[model samples]
Target: MARHNPSAPPESVISIIAPGMQIVGDCQTEGTLRVEGSVEGSIFAGKAVVVGEAGRVIGDITTQDAVISGRVAGNLVIGSRLELQSTSVVEGEVHARRIQVEEGTLLNGSVHIGETDGSTLTHEGQSDSEEQQLPIDAGSWHRPVVAAPKR
Candidate 1:
């Protein structure tokens, strides 16, 4: 039997929730999580979270960073940054250190940027990561093919 370390860093692990699959409970992970399906519960990611255009999430998301091109009907608590694609639809509050929303995106909630404690950053500097732009091509996410059952 192999031994597993619980406190190990997960920068190399990328978890994918493919299309046609539905998750009804909370998901917690230290690695990157890509959602191309539907999730009805909260998601807690330590690194980053990506929601493809075909995905739909009905619960909150807590992550260090996030990119959304789908529908999210819950609050977003992003520690680092949040990117909203043109096709993204978010219907809840958003709290992040930095945010970027492209044209055609639909957001129906309050946005709180800066810090979690409501204190604004008094510095006059911007990091390279903060100046990064959202990707121009996010509609090409893979969509799983589903075959009809034979009668």
Candidate 2:
């Protein structure tokens, strides 16, 4: 569903994936995309992307801003900001200029924050995943989350 009502402005376009719906292919739009169901492919949005509590995504997402409160099983490259609500579960690389994460959010991969260019997070100068360490620069944080050794 598209928010193209008569009163809605032309530039304020919004696409909605209502509940019980499923999209199997990539979705590209210059406006906003509010997902309330499931998506099996990548989503590219110029403005913003919102995933509701029951929403789920199985592929990468590249957007200006994203608010995820459900499950995302792929990488996220957000240009401006990213917010993960308490119910969020993300399982891939996350790159964003800014991030807000709640207490119960489950993140199971690398996280890169305060990086304007989200493309250079290749663990530069690091060869082993087990030995990956967070940079000393506190303002810009990049760390790969790994399981701790058994006690």
* Number of the top-ranking candidate, with TM-score as the measure: 2
Worst 10 residues of 1 by lDDT: 120-129
* RMSD value for candidate 1: 12.9
Number of backbone clashes in candidate 2 = 0
Mind giving the per-residue lDDT tens digits that candidate 2 earns over 1-151? 9967787654379999999999998888877999999998778877888999999887777787899998887778787899999988777777788999998887877787876432432212111222333222222123433323334
Candidate 1 structure quality by residue, lDDT tens digits, 1-151: 1123566567547778899989998887767889999988778877888999999887778787999999887777788899999999887678789999998887766787887664332111122233322222224223331222334
lDDT of each: 0.73, 0.74
Scored by lDDT, model 1 comes in at 0.73
